[model samples]
Target: MKKGMTWLAAMAVCVTLAAPAQAADPIKIGVQGAQSGDLASYGVPSLNAVKIVVDEANAKGGLLGRTIEVVAQDDQCKPEMATNAATKLISDKVDAVVGPICSGPTKASLPMFQEAALIAVSPTATTPGLTEDGKNPLFFRTVANDNAQASLTSDFMLNNLKVKKVAYLHDNGDYGKGFADKNREIMEKGGTETVLFEAVTPDAVDFSAVVRKLRRAKPDIIVFGGYQPVASKLLQQMRRDNLKTPLIGPDGVKDETFLKMTGKDSEGTYASYPKDTSTLPEYKKAREAHIKAFGSEPGFGYYNAYAAAQCLLAAMEKAGSTDTAKIKDVLRENQVDTPLGKLSFNAKGDAAGMGLSIYQVKDGKFVELDHSIVLE
Candidate 1:
């Protein structure tokens, strides 16, 4: 019996000896956004910024002594695909998430992330209702809500442009149309006459019908609330039909894709983007890192994404655990220095103290205009 017991003990020892040492599990972060498709320009730069932030963090020995791992899923800016991406991230055991860039996908993915009790910070996704509705507690964003953006845009139109009549247009998607609606409300409140308020089909190859309407209306300015693909087509059609009304757009139209698509036609168009911070040392470092990694300048949402990742990491470090509730508390209470200046989240999940600036396409590049965010 003693010999048998000794043999059994030896077998246990052998099994234990054969077992590999378990390393500390990595703290995985999921980057969910459009890595391909039409909006790749927006999402890819966001992912690049996150990657640079993560790489730097890892180089310094990842958070809480556990290495951080990044997992990205392309949602193509589609709602259905966003849920799938969120599911994949959850299955991959990610502790937190960074995006689902557009407002629609962000809205669609929120319930799933909520079910998993995962927290996500969006760099874009500016629709007001996303956070204002207060349905999702885990939601946060680095960009101001569409309300702020619309207010700024309206203020620009009412004060700077001083136009008597305005034409408001949107692609009819939640994000675009929501922005358009807000702008419409604010402009009307400011006593500006709405010459034409219309929704354009997102898939329409020709926008001449609407351009014709603008021509007939002869509005002082055209405000287009939509993204690049539709914006490019609409602008081209408008210009082709000789409609020279100044068309102002949202940040969705600020990408290189828009400029490349429209070329000379893109010139003189204005877009409201989050204020440029390239002058800041931190922003410059991030830009250098991005260029090093991707060999080009960062595009739309790049600064916002960098800020989002920095704030997320800062919140995680301050929270001292992966507990989302704790992290959320940290996010609300703490401020992090980002390229966009020191940023913290308001109760509505909008980035506090962030400013928007108007940029005009000049010489094939977006040039910052003198006027900027002066919201009341």
Candidate 2:
């Protein structure tokens, strides 16, 4: 009996010693956004949110027993810089990329990611051209396209505000131009003529010339398609020139930074946002945690970034692999619950059922209106 027990113990020891230990490779997620530039307001908050999501996941044993690491790059809101950042990430062997925030940069870097078979998700790149024909298989966005906001803005202007003519101004970049063009099309179709269309250089210190032109045209409303920095400067200049025609803007201007820039000037100014969920229980909890880490509330773009990070990690967990193809398949087959509510991507990599709602700057805050327009 003693000899038989010894033999069994020896066999168990040999089997245990022969088994190979599993390797714990860190999963790397590349985060590209404007860390320094006018658009940093959009990028910085989103990145902070991404960090929160990653940290939370890491705290819970991570996904698939691997620690997640985020390698962030500053695109500086430039196209060439974005391409270079993507190349660096590819060389670094990142599992996925989370951004390229602005539309131009996103467009520029998307082909590289597609060629490399690396999945990318954009939180703020809202141009309709990105997924128009359903060509991009490896790219996705949490935010709705500009068409969604354009529809809401056009409908609100024509049906509610009763604005017959609008003066359209854009900053000549992909994001600004896309919004301006889509808004023009939607407004024209809704019986609102675009009286004056002009392009302004982004980051121009003085908009006196543009203001003078707008004052002469005197449309019922003025719509500016650009980031908050330019939008605020132009709005301030318009106020100085006394061209207050109830200025409105796209999601780019629906930010606290814009409110601080314009102060009382931002009052009565309307902007369309993805949606406001400040009152939701999930959002409240998330925002509290965010404030504890970042000292502020989440912005319009933050929710999308946070959602993208969570969705990416969740996909990896579901697939039990960091392979891009598996993650992409999981993304298509699953719905992710986030602070922004339930999210699912469509065939074109656009967030299905994602929509927009209008917000008016009132008392130094963006207050959601009772209306919303959804474009699936």
RMSD (Cα, Å) for all candidates, in order, is: 2.4, 4.3
Give the TM-scores of the predictions, in the order they appear. 0.93, 0.92
Model 1 earns a TM-score of 0.93
lDDT string for model 1 (283-353, tens) is 89898998898898888899899999999888889989888999989999898889998889878677887
* Number of the top-ranking candidate, with lDDT as the measure: 1
Q: Estimate every model's Cα lDDT from 0 to 1.
A: 0.87, 0.85
Kindly list the per-residue Cα lDDT of model 2 for residues 15-85, writing each as its tens digit.
77666333566889999989887778889988888889989888998878888898998998899898999
Model 1 weakest lDDT span, ten residues long = 15-24
Off by over 4 Å in 2: 1-22
Q: Show where candidate 1 strays beyond 4 Å.
A: 1-23, 374-376
Pairs of residues at least 3 apart in sequence or in different chains that clash in candidate 2: none
